[model samples]
Target: MESKTTFIIKLVTFYCLCTLNLFNAIDIYHNDSLDDFLQDHAKKSIPKDPKAGKLYDVSLPSNFTGMEVSVVQLQSSSVWAQGANLSYFRVPPRIYPNPNVTWLDLVFSNLGNWSSYYYNMPNYTFVTPILGISAYGVRHAKGQNGQFTSTTTKLDLPLIRHPIMVRFPSVWLPRGKCVKFYSNGRTTITNMSLSHTCEVWGQGYFAIVARVPSTHHVWKLWVIGFGVGCVGFLLCGFVLFKIIRFVEKRKIQKMETESEKSEVLDTKYVGHSKMPCAFGIRTQPVLETDYFP
Candidate 1:
C-alpha cells in the first residue's frame, strides 16, 4: 500500500512537471506573428467600392500638409435584400494633426458587422459622432460628455486587409443610433467633442465611431478584479476544508478512547451460576436411595 501511494504521488508530480514545462514553452512569438500579420495587412490595403463615397466635414489641422484617406472594405455580404456593407479606414503614416482635438464627419451607405463569422452580427463601430484626432491617432470618446485626453501615447491600431464577414439578424439599425445613407443625401450627426478631432491621419482605413456610453469602455479592470476575487475564494475554501479535517480528527480520537475503555472493563454476566456454586453442587448429591439400603 505504501509503495502504491508513493507511485501515485510520483505519477502526479511527473504529470504536473510536464504540464508546467509545456505551459512555459508557450512563446510570445505567436503574438509577435499576429502583430506582424496586422502590419502586413495594413501594408496590403483593400480598396473600398468606388460607387460608395464618404462625405465628412474636413478640418485640416494646422501642421499637416499632405492628408489622404484610404477606405478599406473590411467585409460585406448580402444574404438579405439590404445592400451589403463593410468598411473601415487604415492610416499607416504617423502624420496626425494635434494631440488635443480634431473633428471629421464620415458618411457611408451600408455599415454593418465587421470582424465576425457569418452568424454573429455587428453593431456600429464608432460610439461618438465627433471623433477626436491626436498625435497618436484617432480614437472615440466614451461618456455622456466625451472626455478629452492627450494622445501622445501609442496604441494598437486594427488593420483589416480584406472584408471580414459579420452576422446580423435585424434589418434596420437600432434606435438612438445613427446609420444608413440619407435620402436627402447627408448623414448628419454631432461630433463627440471639439478637443478630439477626426482626420485622415495616415494611409490605412478609417471610420468615425460616434458617442459610446461609458459602460462600453475597456473591460481590463473588471476582468482583473474578477480574477483576484476567484483566487481569494479558493484560498478561503482551502482554509475551511482544513478546519473541517481537524474537527473530524478530534471526533475520531474521542471515539477511539471510549472503545479502549469498554474493552478493559470485563464485566460479569447478569444471570449465570458462579464457579464456586458449580463445585458444591457436584459434591452434594441427594441421599434418597432408602430402598437400596
Candidate 2:
C-alpha cells in the first residue's frame, strides 16, 4: 500500500512537470519597448507620404534574422480607403532566382479583410534579402484627398486595416503602435509613431510583421493534451484507490465472521464434555451384583 501511494505521487509529479515543459515551450514575445527599439533602429529616409506611389529603401536590424515579414495596415472608416494596397520587395531585384524571392503584395478590399498575411522570403536557411530593398504603399483613387488627407496635394492617404487576433506562431502588435519600417535605407528596422499625425497621411502608418517561432503551435497543443491526460490520470487513481479499499474491507469482515463461528463451536464442545449424565443415575454397586451370581 505504501509503495502504491508513492508510485501515484511520482506519477502525478511527472505529469505536472510535463505540463510545465509544454507551457515553457510556447513562448510569447511581447516587448513593451518594441516601439523604442523600432524608433532607434528605423530608417529616417523612408517616405511617409501615402500617395507618393514611390518605393522607399529600408534596412532591417541585425537581430532580425526572420525570413518572412508581414505588412499590417490600420483600419479606417473611410469607404475610399477600402481598396488600399501595400507591397514589399527584396534588394537587388532579379527574375531567375524568383523561388528565392521575399516579395509580398497585399490588397485590402473591405473592412473585414484579415489584418495581416505572411509573405515568403528568399531562402529559409540563409537570412538574406536578395529580391529588392524597398516597400511601397499606394492609396486607392477613392481614398485620395479623403478624410485622412491634411494637405492640398490631392494625396491618397494610406488606410489602416482592422487588427486581428491570431493563433500561436503569430505576433501581436502593441496598442496604437502599428508601423515597422527600415531605418536610413539600411538593414535596421523600426516602427511608426503612435500619434496619427506623424506620417504624411495623418490617417495610417506602415509596419513590418515579425514571425512567430515555428514550435509555438506544437507546444500549445502538447500543453493542452498533457493537461487533460493529467486530469484523467488523477481521476483514475482516486477510483482505483476507492475500489481497493472496499475490497479489503470486505475481506476483513469475512475473516472476522468465520473466526466468531469457530469460537462458538469450540465452546459448545467443551460444555458438553464437562456436563454430568442426564438425570444423575450413575452408581458403583455393579461389583455386588456379580458376587451373588
Candidate 3:
C-alpha cells in the first residue's frame, strides 16, 4: 500500500510539472512576446537616476504606436508605507512584492489598437482597450566588460492587502462590467466600482465587456425577410387576380362564339337590336295533316 501511494504521488507531481511547462509555453503566442517587447524598451528608457519617482515613457516601433507603455520605480519601503499610486493604478497601503524586493519596477501597458488582436472575449465585446500591470525586480548587474547594466526581472506579487484599482479612459456606450482575463485561461466579470474603474486582487490583462446582444441582428434580419416575403405574396396575389379575370372573360367569349355557331336562325340587326329570324316557310306551308278535301 505504501509503495502504491508513493507511485501515485510521483505520477501526480510529474503531471503537474508537465502542465505548468505547457502553460508557460502557451505565452509564446502573445503574452511572452509582449513581455519581451516591454522589457526591451524599458532597458533603453530607464533614466540613469530616478526622475522624482515619475514614470518614463517606453518607445516602441512605429507599428506599435499609440499603445501606451511606461514604467516607474518605487522603493518597496515606500510602497509598504503610503502604497504605490501611479498613473491609472492604485496599490493599497502595505502590499509588498512577493519574494520581497528593495525596489519594484512597475510596468504599465495599454494595448490600444492591438488589444483585440492579442486577446479576445468571446460572446462579449470590448468597449475599451486592454490595460495591464506587471511588477519586475530592479537589477543592476556588473557586465564582463566591467560596466554596470540595468535590467528588470519579472517578480511574483502573489498576495494583496486590499483590492487594486484600475481606471480606464472614458468610453461612450452602454455601461459594461470589468472583465479580468487570467494567464491560465480563466475569466471573471466584476461589477464596475465606478463608471470606468475596476477592483482586482491579482495581476493580469483586463478590460470592460458588454454582453453581445446577438439577437438584435437576428431580429433585424427576420424583419427584413418577413417584409420581402409579404411584398412578394402581394404581387403574386395581384397577378393571380388578373389571370382569373382574363380567364373569366375568355370563357364568356367562347360561350358567345359557340352559341353563334350552333344557331339555326339568321341574326339580323333591326334598328338598334339584333333580331333572330328563321328562313322562309320550308316546302310551302305544309300543314300537320294535308287537308286536300
Candidate 4:
C-alpha cells in the first residue's frame, strides 16, 4: 500500500511537471516577451504602439473622413482570379517609418484593361493635388536572416501617373523610403507632393478601410483549448490509475483465498488417521486374498 501510494504520488508529480511544460510551451507562442522579461532582456520586449492607444472598430466610423479602399479586378478568364497580391501590405515593421502606417503594394498588369478603363471612367476624373509617396525595402526569406533586415530607404514623391499630378505625404516620407512610378506598365520612382491632387490610373479603385485589432478573440480560443487539453490529460491519468489498483486488489484476494483452502486441507489430512481406517490397506488386502483363493 505504501508502494502504491508512492507510485501515485510520483505519477502526480510527473503529471504536474508535464502540465507545466505544456503550458510553458504554449505561452512561448503568445508571449515571447515573458521570456525576455524573466531574463532581464528588455531590449527584446514587444513595444506597444501609442498611435493605436486602444482597440478600435475596424470599419470607418460615422465621423471618419479618412478612408482607404482596395479594389479587386475581375479576371477575364475564370474563377481563379490572379491580380494584385496585396497581402504583403501591412503596418511596416518597427524599423520602418510609421509602423502604424500600413501601405499596400499596387501591381499593374497588361492582361486586363487597366489604363483604358482609367481613361474612360468618370470616377478617375477627380483632380486635386494629393501627395503619392513610395518606399522600398528588401524582402526577406524565412529562416534566412533576422526577421527584419532591410538595407535601402529612398523616398520617391510627386509621382505623375497621368495628366494630373499625384503627390505623396512629405511628412510621412523619410530617408529610408522608396517609390517607383512608371508612365507605361513599367515601374519607376517618382515624387509627388501632397499639395498636388491626382487619381490612380487603373480599371480598379481604392477606398480607405477601417482597422480593428482581433487579439482578444484569438487569445480566448487559445485559453479554451489549453484548458480542455489539461483537463483531458488529468482525467485520463486518473482513470488509468484506478484501473491498475482495482486489478491488483482482485489478484491479492484470489491468492489469499487459495492459501486458506490449502491450509484447511492440510489440517484435515495431517492427524486424522481414523478417516483412512475404513479404506485402509489392511482391510483391502483381506478381501483380495479371499477372492483369489
Candidate 5:
C-alpha cells in the first residue's frame, strides 16, 4: 500500500512539472518558405477559365503604382460558401485590408441568372445590385445544387503614406475554416471540420491572393524578446544559487575557525603551570629543592 501511494504521488508530481515546462515553451512557425511561395504566386498570371473554383491570383494593379489589390473567386459548394447565401454574398466582409489604408473599393458581377431575369423569369432570378465599392458577385446556374459559376471580385486598396504598424486582415468562414494574411507576404490557411448545419451545398472553393507589405521585423523582435527573457531568467536563477552556496560555505568556515580557536585555548591552558592535564595531573613548578643541591 505504501509503495502504491508513493507511485501515485510521483506520477502527480511528474505531471505538474510537465505542465509547467509546456507553459514556458513558445511555438514559432518559420515563414521563410511561405514568403517565397507567395512571392512566386504573385508573379504568376491569372489563368483563363480555370475549371475549379479556387482559381485566383493577387498582384499589383497595372495602372496604380503605389497601391495593392487582390482578385478572388469563390466557387459554389466550397467551404467558404457553406454558410454564405444571397444576404451574405451581397456585402462580403473586407477580409484583407489593413487599418492604415486610406480607402478601399470592391467590385463584383454575377454572370449567371442575369440573362434569365431579363428573359422574363424574374421570380427565379437572384436580385443583386452594386452596393458601393464593396459589392460581391454570385453566380448560380438553373436547377443546380451548388453555384455553377465563380464570382470574380476585385479589391482596390491605398495604403497610408507614412510608416506605421498595420494589422493585416484574416479570413473567417464557417466550419472552422480560416486564413491568416501576414504583412510579410505570408498566408496561412487552417481548415477543420466543425459540426454545424451548412447553408450552401456543392463543391466550391475560395482563393485570396495579395502582396501586402512585409512585417518581418515585428515577428523577429517578438521572438528575440522571448529568447532574451528566457536567458535572463536562467541567469538570475544561477546567480541566486551561487549566492546561497557562498553563504553556506562562509558559515561552515566560520564554525571550523571557532572550533580551532577553542582547541588552541584549551591546549595553552592545559600546559600552564596552574592548569591540570587530561589525566588530572596538575602542572606546577617545584622550587629548587635540597635534593637538587
Candidate 6:
C-alpha cells in the first residue's frame, strides 16, 4: 500500500510539471488593465478644445513612467486627401474609415516597461518597447473642427496606397528584426524601410526583437543526436574488430590442432625451446639421392 501511494504521488508530480511546461510553451499574453486604461483614461489627456490636425501628447501618471501616448483628431476629407504624420508615425494619404464616421481620433501608444508583459517573442528578446496606433470615431458638431462631443466606437482606418510608416526615434538602436503582432496571437514579420522604421498596413502592436545570444547550450536535441551517433559508430566498429580478432584466433588454433594431428610435436626443451619437432621422425629417414646407404 505504501509503495502504491508513493508511485501515485510521483506520477501526479510528473503530470503537474508537464502541464506547467505546456502552459509556458503556449505563451499567451493579454492585459485587461492596460486595455481598460487605454480605452478610458488615455484620451482624457487631450484638451477640451484642441486644434485639429495637430498632435496632443497624453500624459500618464508616475506609475506608468516610461510609457508614452498621443492623440490627433482629423476630419474625414483631410484624412482622405492628406493623411496625418504625427511625429513617430507617417500616415500616408488615401485612408478611409470602415464604417465611414465623420471625425477620427488616432491614439498612439508606446508601452515601454510593460511591453514584455503584454507581448512575447519566443527565443528572442525585445530591443525596444511595443508601439501601437488605434483609431476611433468621435461625435462632434457638424462643420466644426475639434469641437464639443463624446467619443464613439473604434474605427478601422484602411490605407489605400502606401503603408503606414512607423519610426523609432533613437537612431543608435541595435540591429534587430521587425515583428508586428496583431489581435489573437497572430504575428507578421516586416522589413525595415529605414534604419529605424517599419511599414505597416494598419494598426497593431510593433516591436523589434533579436534572438538571444547563446552562452552555453547543453542537452540540445542536435547535440544529443550527434553524441549518440558517434558513440554508436564507435561501439559498432569496436564490435566488428573484436569479432574479426576472435575469428582469426579460432582459425589459428584450428591450424595448430591440425598440424599437431599430422605429427608435428611440441618443442623439446633443448635450449629454452623455440623450434617445433616431429615426434620420432614419422618415418625412417629416406635416401635423398639413393646413393645414401
The residue pairs in collision within model 5 are 77-202, 77-204, 78-204, 106-133
lDDT by residue for model 3 (1-293), tens:
57988999999999999888777545543664676667678757888787646999988766566789998888888878788788788878777787677988888899888788678888888988899888888677899999998666788765456888888886765368899877666889988868778888877778888878688888999999999999999999999999999999999999999987887897789999999888777677657876777
Worst 10 residues of 3 by lDDT: 24-33
**Candidate 2 lDDT over residue span 66-134, tens digit each:** 422333222232223333334321111111111122222222111111122112222121121221112
Q: What's the CA RMSD of model 3 in angstroms? A: 14.2
Q: Model 5: runs farther than 4 Å from truth?
A: 1-176, 179-201, 205-214, 217-219, 230-234, 237-241, 244-254, 257-281
Per-residue CA lDDT of model 4 for 1-293, tens digit only, reads 57988999999999999899778655643442321222121111213222211212223223222422221212212111222222222111112222122321222112111223222222222121111223322233445555655232221212122322222233332222122233243432233333222234322212111122367977998899999999999999999999999999999999999987766432225474533222325443345354654
Question: In model 1, what lDDT does residue 229 have?
Answer: 100
Across 157-245, the per-residue lDDT of candidate 6 in tens digits comes to 77777998888755456456789987677887765667778878888788877777554554476688999999999999999999999
Best-performing candidate as measured by TM-score: 3
Cα RMSDs, all models: 24.5, 23.3, 14.2, 28.5, 25.2, 17.4
**Candidate 5 backbone clash number:** 4
lDDT of 4: 0.33
User: What lDDT does the true structure give each of the candidates?
Assistant: 0.35, 0.35, 0.81, 0.33, 0.35, 0.77
Compared to the true structure, candidate 4 yields what TM-score?
0.21
Predictions ranked by lDDT, top down? Answer: 3, 6, 5, 1, 2, 4
lDDT of residue 54 for candidate 6: 82
Model 1, residue 42: C-alpha shift (Å): 34
User: What is the model-wide C-alpha lDDT for candidate 5?
Assistant: 0.35
**Model 5 superposed RMSD (Cα):** 25.2
- Whole-structure CA lDDT of model 3: 0.81
Which one wins by lDDT: 2 or 6? 6
Relative to the true structure, candidate 2 has a C-alpha RMSD (angstroms) of 23.3
TM-score (all chains, Cα) for each model: 0.21, 0.22, 0.61, 0.21, 0.22, 0.57
Candidate closest to the true structure, highest lDDT: 3
